[model samples]
Target: MSASDWQKSSYCGEGESCIHIAHAAVDHTVRLTESGDPAGVILSATPHAFAALLDAVKENHA
Candidate 1:
């Protein structure tokens, strides 16, 4: 993704090593990376997989 495509997580504060996500340039996948390590490994997930991950996280909190 380009510089303008990646969006920071709204829940993060300034200077935090948070995660960022961007829509894939040419596919139906989400791209994830750390703000502090932009050039590091980029994890990709389908829409369904991403939703399942969020569901699991929410369930853990509940």
Candidate 2:
């Protein structure tokens, strides 16, 4: 993938080492990787799994 395919949200503001998220053009799955370790680890999730993760995070934060 090209550099342009990767994206980060501006919601993080400045000085944040947030992870970058990109969706696969072929499978429509989510891809996750930290900016700090671009070549390190990558985590992929299906739409349903990702949604469940969001729900869990919201519940924990609440």
Candidate 3:
């Protein structure tokens, strides 16, 4: 997937510590930085796994 195609999360805005995510077909790739560096480390995960992570965060915060 192209780095330019990565979509920033709606919750992230003008923040330096925010993470970006890009959809590669049915999988999701997360980027630690938005410097547009080709060497950026990308972590891939399934939609279900990502959703579960979000749920865990919400539960933990609650």
lDDT of 3 at 18: 56
Please, what is the TM-score per model? 0.82, 0.71, 0.60
As for TM-score, the candidate ahead, 2 or 3, is 2
Clash count list over all predictions = 0, 0, 0
Best by TM-score: 1
> Which candidate's lDDT is highest?
1
Residue clash pairs of candidate 2:
none
Give me the runs in candidate 3 sitting further than 4 Å from their true place.
Answer: 26-38
* Candidate 1 local Cα displacement, residue 10, angstroms: 1.2
- Estimate candidate 2's alpha-carbon lDDT, on a 0 to 1 scale: 0.71
Tens-place lDDT per residue, model 1, 1-62, is: 56567788887888747888887768879878877454653688998998999899899999
Q: Give the TM-score ranking, best first.
A: 1, 2, 3
Which lDDT tens digits does candidate 3 get at residues 1-62? Answer: 57786666667767544566766664444433453443564566677777788899899999
C-alpha lDDT score of every prediction, in listed order: 0.78, 0.71, 0.61
Residue by residue across 1-62, what tens digits does model 2's lDDT show? 45566677555656537777777778888777766343533788898998899899889999
